[model samples]
Target chain A: MKLHSLMLAAGLAATASMGMAEKIKVGMITTLSGGGAGLGIDVRDGFLLAVKGNDDIELVIEDDQRKPEIAVQLADKMIQSEKVDVMTGIIWSNLAMAVVPAATAQGKFYVSPNAGPSALAGKGCHPNYFNVAWQNDAYHEAAGKWASENGVGKVVVMAPNYPAGKDAITGFKRFFTGEIADEVYTKLGQQDYAAEIAQIRASGADMVYYFLPGGMGISFMKQYAGSGADVQVMGPAFSFDQGILGAIGDAALGVKNTAHWSKDLDVPGNADFVAAFQAEYGRLPSVYAAQGFDTGLLLASAAAKADVADADAFRAALKEADFQSVRGEFSFGANNHPVQTIYVREVVKEGDVVTNKLLGAAAENHSDAYAADCKM
Target chain B: MSTLLLIEQVLNGLQFGVMLFLMAAGLTLIFGVMGLINLAHGSLYMVGAFAAAATAAATGSFVLALVAALIAAAAAGAIVELTVIRRLYDRDHLDQVLATFALILVFSEGTRWIFGSFPLYLDVPAALAGPVTLPGGIEYPAYRLLIIGMGLAVAAGLFLLISRTRIGIQIRAGEADREMIGALGVDISKLYTLVFALGAALAGLAGALVGAIQSVQVGMGEPVLILAFVVIVIGGIGSIKGAFVGALLVGLTDTLGGVLLPEFFALFTEASSAKLIGASVASMAIYILMAGVLIFKPTGLFGGQT
Candidate 1:
């Protein structure tokens, strides 16, 4: 009996060694606390759901408190102590800029679930870094293109004063050929937009396009409803994100916005992703969550193709972009940023919940403009 | 630049200032009576907001939310005062500062555990949901006008309460000399609890009123807290009259500086650079005004001994 048991154990060990699935260690640094925690929670939950039932991968997640310095420290700890195979899940662009360069410098893989700052897509592009989400300017550029195509006569563009905001404006101007009425930059995280709303009302612009994210978006939408502004409102989908939509309520209804993916998108994997996310989280997935789930799918596909032990092979495999993306036919541009379609979504009431419904494609097979600046 | 626009901007400034007064009144009162630099005063504001949000979500009544905010904040203040704050009263300001700072962490984390990470949503009641034309034909948000009215009414009520009430006299006596008030059978400890609860209720009321307009999140109170400190500094510690004037001054300076500075700089520079510089300078204007006030009248406009 002992000899028979030893033989069975030896046979199982040999089969395990033969299959030899690659083990990948993932360190997720996200904003899990404070005002912006909702976005991070969605990302983390989506990533975990995508990677569920896979024993070959390990994830260590930490909260950065939305601070750049704390993010840097978390990156260092992940690199030296945890010795992670890949680093992902930074929400804020500032935190991404702080951590990505240093982490990618050490030849470790960095997959951005969000925060695809233009600097990285251009001269700052790193071979080890892959942006699974749209570049910071892609949605803004799409909105601008949509605005121009719709024959918007006079329009005002506004954003918070920051690097991402600059990127968003630059993107918007790339497509908008209309007479720009005004270019306004509000203070980052400024709660009250009554003053700015009044300015927009007085400017006599036919339409207003803005790029305020997170809680700023909530405040602006609520205040905008009461601003008595007659101008049409449009923006990037960040403002109408699912995590914040409940707070915004009917204020955002009928407002058009642009994004890379939506639950209503009739893509091959999108329906499944939306259903699976709802099943797992009991809430509709935000764009952030969709990007996070895609990040997992991309990493799983790449890890399946090449051994993480071979850095060049793994990097080459990642560039292949073999995953069935939630956005459909997702591929990386020369800058390692996403080359995908941008959709126009209208905020609508779904039963009691306020959410988005698909309008149509705004930008198809769109590649970021900064790809020409990248060597790889 | 137009007179109508300028008038509208001034109203915006005044509206902003009035909100600050709500926060400053409670903070200044607490500091004056207790001599405690309670950084955790902001926690009370957050407490009120969360309570209001939760109550509004469950009850769907704006009035119920306000009452819940008041009761929750006052009850929390009383509990904190009895259990933790009473011990810090005899300690130095540094100890008080450190202890209260610790309380902020506890309150923030505790609230997070109860509320989760997402900001709770509160809505403006339908009655005040639209814009109303002012006397000058300027289109203004009725909700903001409501805020301004509530703030002014609270200011008047606080004045009446402090001057025409027996509890107000005891509070004044407690501020003057805690030992003397205690010797005179004023039940000084009970007074401290009552005063702390009152300050907390005021902070809660401010939070509930503003939560409709702002993101009702965990750390929303800190920014308002910093400005409230400025309001107290400029108004004179412990003087309700000082808090009101100082709040208006800070609010106006911040708003007008934000608007006019860009136009003023546009004459000398490009519009974009003008905006960049104007905004940077505008944010500094309040602090600059605060410094000037300190240099000229170190005790503040209405402050005496505090």
Candidate 2:
């Protein structure tokens, strides 16, 4: 009986030692299957690529399925069950809003790979939350400024009728003080834009600004081209980025878009990123990929600065905003959102690839307008 | 609006209506004949799209990809019918709904397992790549025109097949009285398989055609499937003519609502407020239409006898 008891005690000590050596857990939730899968997949791949040689972090992946309820549920499970030290990779603002507060409430470090909802950027900002991407409305605000500077009068604005859509229109209107001919909102996943195009033609708008992303953007662009309207069309990066280039093809040519990072940006970090991503995926890295890669690097930098096993320490380290992103030098604001550049770009046919080329840099390390509301 | 723009919008509405019809026809047929609501029908559409994309990527032939899509979707339908659907024929609607919902989970996860969660894209064929100038100086995509033509051809073929053939009589009889027809020596099981495969084939064709224009990935079918359900519901479930009319109504209403609502609001409110209100109302137009229809005609416009 004595020998059996001694064996049991030794077994418990061995198991405890093994537990101490286990990798630090990180939870990553993103939309991995659905219409938004392209962007989410790229972000997931970029994050994985960033952690290629890192042996300390163990990633636990979950798919939110592009639903806010599911995201909140998953965030809860990640925090209470999985007991992850940090959480990351939310693609949509609605989903981000659902998960960010929950993760932060649990005192887990939450790093956003893509979404930067205005609410979290301002009054709702949490110390445990950190966005590696720019504010959701920042790019559109830059586009509005560019349109004003270029003398684009009588501009008609359109976006899918949703919270994000409203944010986009408000962002555009922030800087453009021209004659607003019309503002139109369509269903969030609308596949047709014929009637909208007809209205744009009838309204006599000189240019049309829109903020449709992913599959909706492709469908809208195709129908817009079919409408035979000659009015200039423009949007932010999400409307005509690398993901939709293959689907949109020549239809996207000459379309103006605004974004933070383009494939052709001349910085050495950008060039290296573009080359590495192209070499790895055989396609140019999109702003989504760049943001995701930066997110991974950001996490790694924070981990290096503090003991990742100590969750509170890691969270504080990330909040300190010490990392180099491919979008050039950027730092987190008090609201846990990045102050980043936004560029106005034009879609052009270069060789066989249709891509967005930088037309002009519109805003430099610009913070969101809602930053004032965020008392973080 | 300019004449050209009006003409283009009309064509767009027609094109959208055609796509919705492709989805609705199969749903109405299955519901009419089987008396079962199969929510997993969208899973078949996703399967067809992924199959087409994978085959096309491998062979570099759009024609082969389309053929593969049809075969794959049909095969999947038949297998699902034999394993899961056959048992649910006599069950209540609640059971059928639950079973099909489970099937959706299986199909979606199975698809993800095979495709590794990446979107597969199919390219538009060179034969129908560019925009063609139509009458009234309106430019339309040749591929879209092809889709519209294919939809019409299928509609005509379905009408002929239902009216002019011996199997058509069996199908009609089966729809009217299943037990009596089965007792009369017709093999009902084989007939059920045939109908399911046919419905799956139609859905597959729609998926393959649309896959060229959009990203082919998991869960691509859910939205269209819901819209198709709305079409069939408005058209009267199990009625092909109703499906066609319902699809067109929805297509036009949804397309025009987005454009007209904001302008109407602009008359009374600021431009931004008008847009917000108009868009919100436009998004709810179809649901409002559905509710209005249900209030007056509880059985749907052409739903034979509720």
Candidate 3:
């Protein structure tokens, strides 16, 4: 028995010494097979592309179907069954809120690739939680600032009636010190926007700012074009992303949107990312994809610098954000969310394909308003 | 809100109602004749939209796209009725619901597999694109006016077919006494298939018309399906007339409620808070109307002894 124990001890010591290259398991809960699947797919593709040759990171992706309950269940499974050291890849803010706090409380590192809800960015923030993406209100605030700068008066703002939707309008209102023509809150998954378009036409607004994301945005833009409402339409990049711009077609052309990253951003790693993403996925990458790529780089950098088992060291490394981001110079704020420049992009047709052309920074080196409330 | 805006909203409500009527007409007919609840009817609608989108992309012909939508949706419906729906005809409502719900999953996943999750573009044809000014200086999309006209024409044609044709006699007979119609040698299964196909075609037509304005994506049918169900329930299970009235009422309530409620609440609250309150309440307006209809007429407006 003593001889056998000595042999086992020697084997364990050898394994421990060889554990420097240990794989970090990341569980991604994203909408993969539903209406919102396009965003999640881009995020997954970009993340996978960034860590393509690096075998040190193992990603287990689950389709949340954009459901909060399903996201919670998946987060539980990731933490308990899969025993993932890191969790990420949630696109919707509600799903992020459903999964993030619980995962962080359980001593698991939660890295947000897309969603950055106000609650998580504020007092509910955890040291183990890091958001590579901007806060939920960042892009909307950028649009507001852009609109205010351009002397856009009497703007009609609209969004779906959900947490992020409320956040979007609130953010826009914060920086837009103009006469509000009207504010419309629509159903979460409503396709038809006839009623809303009629209201916009009659409201006599110089510009219409809407935050309808995914298919909702596509529907709204198409209908708005057909209505010939004679109002300038604007929104954040979520509505004009590369994944959806083609679907929106000419209706989206010349429309201004705000985002932290664009395909045409004159950043160090952005050109390579754009080329690599197009080569890999046969399409241009969206801001979500850029965020996903950054998240992968962030995790990889932390893993290379410090062992994930050492929570304090891993957290500190993640905070450093030592990796090169596609969005140019990127860093985390007091709230653990991105402090980055948000660019204004106009939807333009580039050689038969609809894509965004960078119109310059809407808000440079901006941080979230909620950072003051985050203690950690 | 100005009088012109109200009138425009009414027109928008009418267009929405007419679209719902197309969907409800099929659903009511299937439930009336088959006594089988096919939850996959929405899948047929999705099939139609996808068919239109694909054909439009390939041919760039709006008329051809619409024709393809009709044919594809009818063919899909016929196939589903022949292969799976017929089996559930004699089963209980719960079983039919279970089977059809499974078909929804299959259709959703299958469509996603074929067309991908990205929404396909299907814009209104140039001739129908852009708004047309009305008598009261109110401008409305010409395409919406077309939808309203087409819906009315379809309703009239359906009425004529049901009240003044041989198949209509058989259908009414089948609805009244299925076994008796079969005993009288009326090829009941064939009739069922024809009715199912017809219903599916109507749904597909609605899908095509709406797809021009909406995103043609997977799971687009389900939301409209719920509203269609409310329409059929409020109209009466098997009554086409009931479906028409119910659809119009629901559409007006939903559209106008969304517009007017916020204005009404704005009187009592701040503009932003009023919008929030009005929108939340407006979403519930249709259900409230449905409940009111149910309270007054449990069997539905036209649902009574045949």
What's the DockQ of model 2?
0.49
Instruction: Mark the regions of model 1 whose C-alpha exceeds 4 Å error after superposition.
Output: A1-20
lDDT winner between candidates 2 and 3:
3
Model 2: share of native contacts present? 0.51
* lDDT for predicted candidate 3 compared with the true structure: 0.90
Query: What DockQ do you compute for every candidate structure?
Result: 0.67, 0.49, 0.81
Clashing pairs in 2: A122-A374
Off by over 4 Å in 2: A1-25, A56-58, A278-283, A308-316, A348-353, B1-8, B51-68, B113-118, B123-142
lDDT of 3 by residue, B96-156 (tens): 9999999998999899999997889899999989899889788889999999999999999
**What local lDDT score does residue A89 receive in model 2, on the 0 to 100 scale?**
86
The better-scoring model by lDDT among 1 and 2 is 1
TM agreement with the true structure for every prediction: 0.95, 0.89, 0.96
Better of 1 and 3 by lDDT: 3
lDDT of 1: 0.86
Summing lDDT over every window of 10 consecutive residues in candidate 2 chain A, give the lowest-scoring window: A1-10
Q: What pairs collide in candidate 3? A: none
The deviation in Å at residue A8 for candidate 2 is 29
